[model samples]
Target: MFSCSTMMHIPTSQFLKLSKFKPIPDPRCKTKVATLSMGCFWGPDSLFGSIKGIMRTKVGYTGGSEPDLPTYKSIGDYIESIELYYDPSKITYLDLLQVFWNNHDSTDKSSYRQYISAIHFHDKEQEQQARDSMKKMEETKSNSIQTLLMPYKTFYDAENYHQKYILRKYKIFLESLCLNDDEIKNTYAACVLNGYLGGHISETEKVRILDIGLSDEQLRYLEACL
Candidate 1:
């Protein structure tokens, strides 16, 4: 049965055929990591990439016992989560939490745990802040907060098809990055482009894109895709 929240509606045969490209390295890796589960991972994955200070984002599975079996069809026991790498100096964990609550139905409970809203905190500060944010959110709404706030244990990267889904729709934009399938799934530049292609990009984000080492022709192609 297809869950209303799942985005795996396309037949396997109809999936986009993407080409393999060479790797273009991103030097920046000093950033804080935050993970969240807010229904479908694809939506949140695209959403956070748009925000300033968010360096990179990846869709994965967590909050389950059997981490090995987290395929879309078998992820019933796991929560679909987006792991974010962000610069705390630019964007705080609380700020991301604010976006989390705003972007999805935090008060609504999912029939399956996989799509449930959650904040997978990584540290004591994050834990305290996440709980505080939940309380603050609860005070603002009539409905009870149903989001799961817990310490992050393990995160299993989702399948390749699940990575940069929105950006993948614009195959040309992806090819511009010059990344192979494996590298594309984890590239910081890809994350920014994913958000832009997903419709959450800002002017500042566009400038950032221009500065990320893409050639003039590639930039034109990416702009066209947008």
Candidate 2:
């Protein structure tokens, strides 16, 4: 399933009222962009969602010689990847490349088993670019970048149940966490989370309901989202 960045809900009217706070606007990303696989898509989606320049992101399967559709039950059968649609005005491919390096452990190749931790690159340019970016990161950040940058192949869309996982979980999670804000519907992002939270039982549902880890307000937030 796809991971999601935090999308807090705020009503449109109230959101406008609070616009004085200058919340980070959605990404200006406008091109068809792709990134290879990692262990999971949810966390990656969540991480990317945190960035301001991203417009939209999708989670799917990539790296196999042919298109490989990964089922939730068969998640292990495929490599987890993401396809991002972004506005070039907000973030550059170079910028997203940096994120790719930062988000996952891309330090070795042979050790990166293709069946499992194999990090594939979509093209020769992207492969080389990843290497170049790693070098730059090493020289400037005092560290080396390492990841298996393989070839571009095919990508298959995951099942519908797997899409927007975090959003769905966010709703149920908030209800369980009690992290609710009554003004949810007014804001786009938060509403997304709220819709998800309210719509389905999160993959983490059993544990959350079982754990007394939330504060009063957090519990309220969860309730509010639900």
Candidate 3:
């Protein structure tokens, strides 16, 4: 829960400059990448971004035979996927895989290739883990899972508008952040706020965010946005 006392002191004008409040990882911190497709990338982008350890999230098209670049309007044979950058010390790949399986209907078949469930593993280790996890899921259901396990390949970024779907709806918040196109797509603050707006953030996560040195005015703005 947000602390009411923390919401009463700082000036509102200070909160309007949100870039100052954006979280930045330590320069020496190590991060890992994970990419997967479980249908529309919008939901998963917000879902994964809500997790504490994720550094950034981006939605794109991948796992296709098309030679040209893919966009939402002309996706070709590609799948709608999201790529995640996370702090390994705080979250493991196995943790992300569990979240993936729990949130999407991996066992059901999709007529559209773009919406099919798949995991694009970045390395051999990830591939093995994904396969092992899938095997367990298959055993649990006593039926084969439809999700595909594929090696990492090209990930053509989606158009800017599709990047942070839910968060983009709040124009005032975006204006406050004063972010350009690239910043909006990759910034940590945008990632966290997107999850909050999508209703994926938990009370514990809310407290975690509040403890990140935000001023009183910023806390008020965030709670209001929520």
Candidate 2: how large is its RMSD?
11.6
Model 1, CA-based lDDT: 0.76
lDDT of 2: 0.49
* Clash pairs, model 1 backbone: none
TM-score: the better of candidates 1 and 2: 1
How are the candidates ranked when ordered by lDDT, highest leading? 3, 1, 2
lDDT digits (tens) for residues 65-164 of candidate 1? 8736778888757888889988877888889988988888888887888888889999999999999999999999898989988889788899998888
Of the two candidates 2 and 3, the one with more favorable TM-score, higher being better, is 3
Per-prediction TM-score to the true structure, in the order listed: 0.85, 0.54, 0.85
lDDT for every model? Answer: 0.76, 0.49, 0.79
Query: Tens digit of lDDT per residue, candidate 3, span 38-75?
Result: 88787888788799898789999999998888888899
lDDT of 2 by residue, 143-210 (tens): 34444466765666666444544554443333342323322212224323422343333545423322
Give the Å shift of residue 142 in candidate 1: 1.2
- Runs in model 1 deviating more than 4 A are 1-29
The better candidate by lDDT, 1 or 2, is 1
Top candidate by lDDT: 3
